[model samples]
Target: MRALTPALAVFALAAVASCSGAPDEDIPRRICGTKISPEITRPLIGRTGAFNEYSRLDNKSAQTAPCDLLLDEKPVMSFRFAWSSDQVDPMKYADAESTDSVSNLIEPRRTRDRYKSVVGDDGAMATVACEKAGESHFTLTMKLPDATKPDTQLRGDIEKFMTAYMNATVKEFGCRSR
Candidate 1:
């Protein structure tokens, strides 16, 4: 009983420090030397839902940017930052959306189906997925264009533009039940 008290106190202290209600910059980063820039990440970075108004802590799980636009003062559809982990290979991801599930994304793009993805300009790999909830979400992944190589090993394509090409492929995620 006596040893348990000390352990409990230490745990309590850790929770308090982490939950201090400070801004993201003030809080320690998540992992993988990952940093957050508030200028790029506003209230909700990758949220796509009907927004009559905006508020802080509205969509913490998703990534988003603020907008003062001609269309509306709403969150711009975008993606959370890429995740880098030693345990897991550094892989890009779209922030989980309120309307989307894994099943939807991996399915075919049929009228009966409820998912779609779009890869835009090469600078960054971007995907916009929509679901039956009438909510459309977006996910942008960092581009590592210099990683893929042509099939020909001896061919000059790999030698010429290997380092300059982006390895992070923004290929259309086709429907495949794996």
Candidate 2:
């Protein structure tokens, strides 16, 4: 069996450490900010309607949100890498692109041609996937709760979180598809 490397281990540690909260409060943050679709859930639930973090790995009853402000909750990171050449599911790609019911909790506004991002009353992020295929690779990024604006630094955290999940997906290719 191949052995572990020190550099690989340190990188893992750093990724987990930054997963929660902004590195610094002053820096702009892009959390699964209260993207709660207003249509579903009780209205006037308060701007601080309180958010919950459920594990993509497992479901649990619930608990106090790790962050008091909804903007502080880190979205569960996930990705789909199109790598296999022979036979892959077109429906799978289609589902994410044309028919993903990530959450039917909100009405969609015309955001762009590629996809419509339906923001819930709480501001949780989901996507109507658009595939820009590369020769042998395409990446699907679920950047839930992305910061609303284009603060360049905020995008860094987005890339960091996405890269970590994508790399994990590439490594754990045998796990069940979501």
Candidate 3:
């Protein structure tokens, strides 16, 4: 009846407004400790190793696990993503402490930590770290392929690869992308 019509209309309008857009509550939220899916690591494998060679350090029991990439059945690179309320903020840590004095000429501006490099007679190693939503932080460490230390070009490529991978992983995992 006409008396009930007005009340129904108000309720219907409120319902529609509530669901109109993807409010913050509707957006996917990643818990700080959600497990990294295989889909995330798949693209980063590249030619370094077969996807089958990947393994979680804790047997995937924990949401965030250290992982390794193996090539020719040898460990090529190892990385992990961890977020903790008690842990120092990665951005602040980078600013305060100089973990590695290696120059950060090729480091991406968006990253919270400067790219660190170590080149030795054996090979080269690089580390990239970033934070998301001021809550989730990730670090990726890679062992460069060549036996000799990587030159400038190799270093640049490593920076690019790690930056791309970090961005993609953040976006894929429902975190704020850099």
Candidate 4:
């Protein structure tokens, strides 16, 4: 029994030693590094849903990964980084909406926030041009909530919020404005 006791002790020690440096369980949920903060989203969208990562398919059959902030299970806001190789011109987006009803009404104009409300759509949109890490024309869009009856003052307020939100994103991501 004494001889067996030494073997058992060795076995116990070996078992513990083998498992001591075992890898930890993999955690699946990771926050998308888009710098969408609660301070910017809560006032506009009430409470934000979980951080989501998704890919958008561009016209050239390429994918652009974006960090999304969802509200009521819909992605009302998103941020993405891209290179100039994609040949995406953020300013040209306004031209595409020229046929919309609101396009004739308000005309998609560039202000501090670059907001363009769709004539017949439910919400407003803003796009900011960013230069990320020396790559020019990197852009991000802040999709504001839909206003049932958006007046001039309400649109002004939305633009202010969108500008502040874009500024916060710029500061957080260390990107220069283009």
How well does each candidate superpose onto the true structure, as a TM-score? 0.18, 0.27, 0.41, 0.47
Q: Which ranges in model 1 have alpha carbons more than 4 Å from their true place?
A: 1-59, 65-126, 130-135, 151-178
* Candidate with the greatest lDDT versus the true structure: 4
Per-residue lDDT for 33-102 in model 2, tens only? 3222232211112123234444322112111123222323634322222332233333233333346443
Relative to the unseen true structure, what is the Cα RMSD of model 3?
Answer: 16.9
- Reference-based TM-score, model 3: 0.41
lDDT of 1 at 108: 19
Clash count, predicted structure 2 = 13
Worst window of 10 by summed lDDT in candidate 3 = 26-35
**lDDT assessment of candidate 2:** 0.31
Q: What is the lDDT of candidate 1?
A: 0.27
Q: Assess each prediction's global lDDT (C-alpha) against the native.
A: 0.27, 0.31, 0.40, 0.43
Give the poorly placed runs of model 3, Cα more than 4 Å off. Answer: 1-51, 57-62, 86-135, 145-147
Pull out the clashing pairs in model 4.
102-119
- lDDT, candidate 1, at 26: 33
| Highest-scoring model, TM-score | 4
Tens digit of per-residue lDDT, candidate 3, span 1-178: 9999999999999998655433333222221223333333322232332322354543122144555455566655445554432333333232213464222222322332343433322222333333444543444334433323335434444445455455554455564323
| Candidate 1: worst-modelled 10 consecutive residues by lDDT | 82-91
Query: Candidate 3: lDDT of 97?
Result: 32
Q: Per-residue lDDT tens digits of candidate 4, residues 61-174?
A: 223445554544566544453445343434354344554321122334455434222221222334445556445444444444343445553455445555655555446666
lDDT of 1 by residue, 1-178 (tens): 9999999999999898555433445322211112334323222222223333222222223323321111034423212332121111111221223143321211112111121222212112233331212223433333212213222321222212211112121122121211
